[model samples]
Target: MPKALLTIESLVKNYGGGAVLNGIDLTVYEGEVLVILGPSGCGKSTLLRCINALEPIQAGTISLNGEPIRRDSKDLPRLRQKVGMVFQSYELFPHLSVLDNITLSPRKAQRRPRQEAEAEALALLDRVGLKDRAGDYPRQLSGGQKQRVAIVRALIMHPEVLLFDEVTAALDPEMVREVLDVILDLARQGRTMLIVTHEMQFARAVADRVVLLDEGRIVEEAPPEEFFDHPKTERAQRFLNTLTFETVKKKAKNQ
Candidate 1:
């Protein structure tokens, strides 16, 4: 059995007297890829942000390797180094070149030597087919290229667990596969990850286990094969129906 690398228990978050996440419980095992699926306003993005302390929790605890963490803790920065997140927006610094962008976190946040950070960043860029573009500014790269650099930026930190919050949601159709392929490559290498996305096809292709969330709670969790075909809850079934209908509409539009 795989060990649990990230653990969340009775997780809760509120927004202006309203609960966005209501008592959620989840565990991500080492080497596991968990894809969280939910409709709009279901708090999927909030959940990922909470883990990295980007969103403060109103209740419960998040732990990594069994040690509890909090937004107010002095160790937050140290804890965050092991948990990296990539957002839907490329969020790249427009003025920085790709090399500088990817190296910034390690060199500045972690205080690694510039030469050391650059070497690691270059290797990551090479893997993602962006080695030559290292000198190019964010404005000089395509949306896909900028996103690729964002992924490299997170990886350069050497995180233990990565969170992807709709990483491909901002990409064009043609660019989607490139980002997904990079994520798939990481998954195959046994990187533990939690992904929040509406891309059912990509989720099915990448998730070892899929979690269906509705109204801030997990309605079902199952292997991708099972979850896609045999969702256990009525809410999940309805959600799957919508996904299927959308897929059909997309295909019809293409033809």
Candidate 2:
């Protein structure tokens, strides 16, 4: 009840004859980390895209801090500045150095002075533990480092809400930890975040709420302990079972 930072009501997204997101509704409060978990192709990423207006919502409304982001609104550019997105692909410019990648948008999009934007970008890089890689290009950095740079780039916009679309999915097993560590740090700082992720451990450790999506619908949602321990829906139970079995089998092999 801290007054929702993000509100999605009756959200719908369709592609051709198939519905990618089916009448979804959810709210994210300030200073909370909300993890959206679901099987592949369940519209988790599409939902995030729709919220940020990267994908036009076929229907419903998405409001950030009480201002609605409708398809007809002329204020989308300003609205997008308040919502930052970090994708799984780490969509960095190969031609630019890490520092440039981080500062480019702020300098151009926000119309800030170059020096000011660079200073802010460096600070963000430092926060993400990438200060040493400032001059490195995307091709020179590891997957984890590139993703970190992407996060810093998004943060440079000073967004009010952050949307992460399975940021660790493409990272190597070892690299995933580094990215998750940074995300956990962000959560500790009370950043309002909505993440689509498969990492149940990260969700259990950092998320204030867990929303389970299945075939474009929210199947269940609750606190981590409640959702993981007592998943109510058949879809949630089956998903958890699959993950648990896979984890157990992997652990046994390792042992």
Candidate 3:
């Protein structure tokens, strides 16, 4: 059996006396793309945040590469450097140029020399097809370009695992494809990824496994074809039926 890169055991998170993640358990293998699909407010994003210690879990444990991400751990910074996150909003530093945004974390967290960091950042920018936009500021780029820069920024950190939180959610219809293409490319390269997305087709195309979450619990976990074609639970079936591939295909075609 392959060693799991990330493990969550009996995880729980609550806000205002209500549970967002209720006794959840999951494991992500190395070099696998695991896509979490669910309705809004089902705690998928919160689950991703908890994995990286961005959100405080109310109960249970999250371990990355066998090391638990405890709140008080002095090595949390080092842990974070190995876990890259790309958000929906493409949180670029407005004051920094694209190249600077990509290099900043490596320089500060890894203590890399400026020239070495810039070289790595530029290589990452090239990988994301944004090599020409190195000197551009965030305000000057389109939403897709900005998101690509965000991906490049995260990649420059040399993370062992990447977390994508509804990365295409904030994109326009046309822009969504560009971002998804980048993700698909990474998936092909065998990057370990945990993605929360509503793009079922993209999930079907690239995910090694699809996990359906409802009310903070996993309703179903299966390969994409099986999960879409033969959902094991009523909730899963309902969700799948609601997302007809024909409808989504037509919408994409029109866009």
Candidate 3 per-residue C-alpha lDDT over 137-251 given as tens digits, one digit per residue, 9 for 90 to 100:
9999999999999998888888989999999999999999999999999998999999999998899998999999999999899999999888888999889877776777888
Candidate 2 RMSD computed on C-alpha atoms after optimal superposition onto the true structure: 3.0
Worst 10 residues of 1 by lDDT: 241-250
The total of clashing pairs for model 2 equals 0
Lowest summed lDDT window (length 10), candidate 3: 240-249
lDDT of 1 by residue, 96-212 (tens): 888999888898889999999999998999999999999999999888988999999999989999999998988899999999999999999999999999889999999999998
Backbone clashes in candidate 3 total 0
- Tens digit of lDDT per residue, candidate 2, span 1-255? 597899999998999889999999999999889999999999999999998888877788999999998767899888999999999999999999999999888988889999999888888888888898999899999999999999999988989999999999999999999999999999988999999999999999989999999989999999999999998888899999888877788889999
Given candidate 1, what's the lDDT at residue 8? 98
lDDT of 2 at 137: 91
- Against the hidden reference, what TM-scores do the models get? 0.95, 0.94, 0.95
The lDDT per prediction is 0.92, 0.92, 0.92
The TM-score measured for candidate 3 stands at 0.95
User: Which regions of candidate 2 deviate over 4 angstroms?
Assistant: 246-255
Worst 10 residues of 2 by lDDT: 241-250
